[model samples]
Target chain A: MDATPQMTCQTAREAFPEFLDFRTAPTARMAERSHLAVCPDCQREFATLTRIATALDEAPSALPSGRMRQRFYAMLEEEKHSARSIHLAAEREHHARGLSLWRRLGLPLAGCALLAAGFVGGTRFSARSPESQDHSDPEARRQLADLQQRVNAMGQLVGYSLIQQRHSPTVDRLQGVLTSASRENPPPQVINELISALALDPSAHVRLSALDGLAAHLEQEVVRAGVLACLAREENPLVQVSMIDLLATARDASARPAIEKLSTNVTTDRNVRDAARRALAQL
Target chain B: MLAVRDGELNALGELFERHHGRLYGFLLKLTGDRSTAEDLTQTVFQRMLKYRHTYRDQGNFAAWMYHLARRCTADHVRRSSAAPRPIDPADLNLHADDAPHAAGQASVHDDHRLLYAALALLDRDDREVLLLSRFQELSFAEIAGILECSVGAAKVRAHRALRELRDAFFRLQRPTPPVS
Candidate 1:
């Protein structure tokens, strides 16, 4: 950091940043300042550099608009909420699956125990009431059904919310649809959400997955009609082919027009047209 | 940032609020486009979150953030290399109409505008080195870390960039002879 009598202009210029910003130690700054005092060329160079730095410091730049901030926070919130919901859904699914197994076996066992107790009591009391036993048993079954319904409703809500997210990654949206569709008895509303995704999702892969989801629920007349309609409007050949396959698998007569249209359209991919023709034959 | 690494997402928001203005300014100077600057600023924070685990407690956060910023800009350049254009001062969003102070702030002498124009002509790496040192006000050590080079090399690069900038300024100052 020492300044020598022979300090060249090149060496002096090296400290431009430190000198410009006063980052140099006091002793070094003094020596550099003295060198600039003596060297005219280096002094002029330093002046121009100062002006440039000053102008740069004052250079105008735009602040991010409120819309940008809103977009960022919206994205962040979606990520946070999605992460929490996914975690909760995984836990709930695990617990509910376990509970469902228990209900399958436990309900019968409990019923047998209650009947056995009723038969034993009947022997002791000649006027034991049959209506009392039937009443409590049906109530217990109804309670289990209610709990199951509530769990399904929660899954449907989470799935619907996730599918509706505008900025979510394709994989995440597809995952939500798949998770809901994988349930043994998904609600009709959940099926409708998947159908919407199948018809409207920007990503072909997402649409194809949505078609896969709706394929399993084709027994529902609404789901069948939705998938058939999606096939006619689907722009992606892969998704269109998949939709045709789904309809063909369901033996849906409503899909015949869509399949015939694709079959006759020369602009369609050769594979897609052939698939559609095959689907029409199946229907 | 440490809290963010430990799964406290709200901490990330605090960091964003504190650093976003400077981050956006740096990006605007680098890309010379407001929209790109905004996009890169968001990408920088998103990267901070995604790679938060890699952050060392003893590391300089500013250098780390700029490293990500450099990468983001590099990616953007690569994606749009086919249509590179010179940055126009007019493209700079000075908010002159909205803020009275901005009118004076955005106005610079002819030489200063020439300096900026020359700056745009330098190599991308040279522009980056100079901007990181001068505008960002980072020490050579921090600049070296962001550039992944030695401190001496960073200083040398900055000096060369300054030298080129001065030469460009002088070249721009030369008046063309009256067109015959």
Candidate 2:
């Protein structure tokens, strides 16, 4: 018990070897424990180390202050707002870039995107011409460049006509209206719009045409969600199969509940249900 | 999962209010920094949000949260403390807490401070196992789940961590750290 300071440090060094093998060495353990029975130095060291370890566990920590929490949350909100603004600005810039090419032909595609407005409770409204809205007006360029300032005012998103108009380009213009439409187009919506246009077109051939264009974009989660929603309700088995096939491309686990429900529906064709199950497994 | 997916801010705020204290205390102990622990705690919740869909049930929520927290903590420790050239004296900083063994330094109060400083020297993993087992009141199975090890391995780990901790205490000039 009366070991020199150097002697105790040496004994502690020897004891550490047991700790090195502490996970597996049975003999090292016995030796260390036996040494602890007579050596007060080792015991003291052991006590101090564990006490800090435990006290740390028990020590109380304050939750972030309300101000800090607000600051963090506000910062997140700011990020989201900036993200949205940037998205909108990009879409505008895309349209603007596309229109710049069209405006070279002196056509009014800028007015066409703005022509989406339906006024006075479901009635169509267009005033005079862009030239009168005044073509000479300095604001005319601002109006043409105003995509960035604009917001999506269509609450229900039923303006599929503008989309149909936007996409159906005439071969007379071989350069075609590149319509920054390709630029900031939300890839998911572009797919769904194509699918909807294909399904509802007067000519079933165009519906098939729409499918070819949409098929390339089908391999993503957000796009698949729209396809699945349409498929679950589609009476046409052929369209249902196409939607089911598209679901195979989505990695979304959120589709499980819907897929599970579809699995049990007896009225659905056996072939379609089997496909849904197989696709469900992939997700 | 409901608190996360439903975007229920109140629900998430309550969850943060309930769990943040323990997570901060545990991470601070593991990393030994207030700011890093704070940032890591926030990162854990952000991760919880990112992978919310994988959550099946809330039955073992605490264990699951700790599972993610401990994994991230281990990664942090690994990045912060890398293995250097062969076991030099500096590598044995963990074992050197028992020094400055002057006589009569082992008072009831010294016993308190000595254990505190000694713990800072133990490897982060051993410190984690000891803290979770003894203070968090997690069972060996839960500890295994949190530590991502088997129950048998967790018991062995606990024993080993406790022994190393005991040795570290002796090196600190304290007689014996009181057992829980």
lDDT of 1 at B107: 44
Docking class of 2: incorrect
Error of 2 at A180 (Å): 21
The TM-score between candidate 2 and the true structure equals 0.41
| Clash-forming residue pairs, model 1 | none
TM-score of each: 0.56, 0.41
The residue ranges of model 1 lying beyond 4 angstroms of the native Cα positions read A1-5, A29-32, A93-283, B82-87, B95-112
Encode model 2's per-residue lDDT on A1-283: one tens digit a residue. 5334344444543454234322445565454456665677777766554454454433333344345466446644654566569789999978986864464333443444455442222122214443535546766556545633343322112233334543334321112112212333434455556656544544434444454455555565545665556565566556655666666665656667776777778988887788778878887
TM-score of chain B taken alone, every candidate? 0.85, 0.73
Best by DockQ: 1
- Assess candidate 1 and give its lDDT: 0.75
Across residues B1-25, which tens digit of lDDT does each residue of candidate 1 receive?
8887887877878888888878887
Off by over 4 Å in 2: A1-68, A75-283, B78-112, B174-180
